[model samples]
Target: MMLLPDAEQLLANLTERMRSGVATDTAIVGIHTGGAWLAERLHHDLKLPLPLGTLDISFYRDDFDKIGLHAQVRPSDISFEVEGSHIILVDDVLYTGRTIRAALNELFDYGRPSSIRLAALIDRGGRELPIAPQYVGATLALPSDKMLALEKSSTGKLSLRLYDKNPMGHEQ
Candidate 1:
């Protein structure tokens, strides 16, 4: 397996991208877990006007029937009005594109945003959908059998891991 980039380096790259394009009116929303964690940091670093928003897209997933429900499904939270607001949707990893698709559906449920720009820490290309990120911290290519995941320690340190996707599930 290839060495994963340091989380700090990836965050620095993401910070630079956001600093350049994001405007005052743009709101930040992160997809659950890793994405939310990344978004929280970005919101604080960028000093965005609105509070950080988090999304739990378990219910909105296209493969909900096949995968069933995830155990830790949290409610999607967006305190600010979404109508006509420019959105910066953040995620830790951009893989199959389904998560982003679900995130979009859940976001629209709250309200329609003027625009949504995708931001991701890593882009490992295995897209099943036509989704692409506007801002990417790092990009890597791996085989279909291997899965990349973000790990956040209790103390808030971030790391990455690789897993083998098996027929039953994942082998970590």
Candidate 2:
């Protein structure tokens, strides 16, 4: 596993993209796990006025029946109004796009947004849905057996890595 770009670079790119769009009253929302990790770092960097929102797509996932329930489920947290708010959704990686689909469903539960843009640390391509990330730190192309993960150090640093995972669901 190798460390890719650090959080500072990622935040720079994200802020640039958000600036180009000129979104007003922007809010940041991050999916649980890896996305949440990246979001925390971004919130500090961007200094968004609204509180950071978190979405756990576990229950909203389409593969819930096949993947079963995750042992650790973190609830979605969005206290402020979402309607007409410019929401910048953050995620660690953008791949099959299923997670974003689930996240959108969970997001509407809070309220509809004026615009929903996505930001990701890595875009691995191979999207199953029509989703796309407006801001991406890097792009990677890996084999089907390979997977990506983002780790956050206690000192508030972000690291990206590639790993191997069994797509068959036969290996844990």
Best by TM-score: 1
Instruction: Estimate the TM-score of every prediction.
Output: 0.94, 0.87
User: 10 in model 1: Cα distance from truth in Å?
Assistant: 0.4
In model 1, where do residues sit more than 4 Å from their true spots?
169-172
Per-residue lDDT tens digits for candidate 2, residues 33-53, read: 888777766776666778888
Q: Encode model 1's per-residue lDDT on 95-167: one tens digit a residue.
A: 9898898899989989889999999999998888899999999998888888778889889888888887766
- What are the lDDT figures for the candidates, one per model? 0.87, 0.77
Model 2 lDDT, full chain set: 0.77
Model 2 regions more than 4 Å off: 1-8, 19-24, 167-172
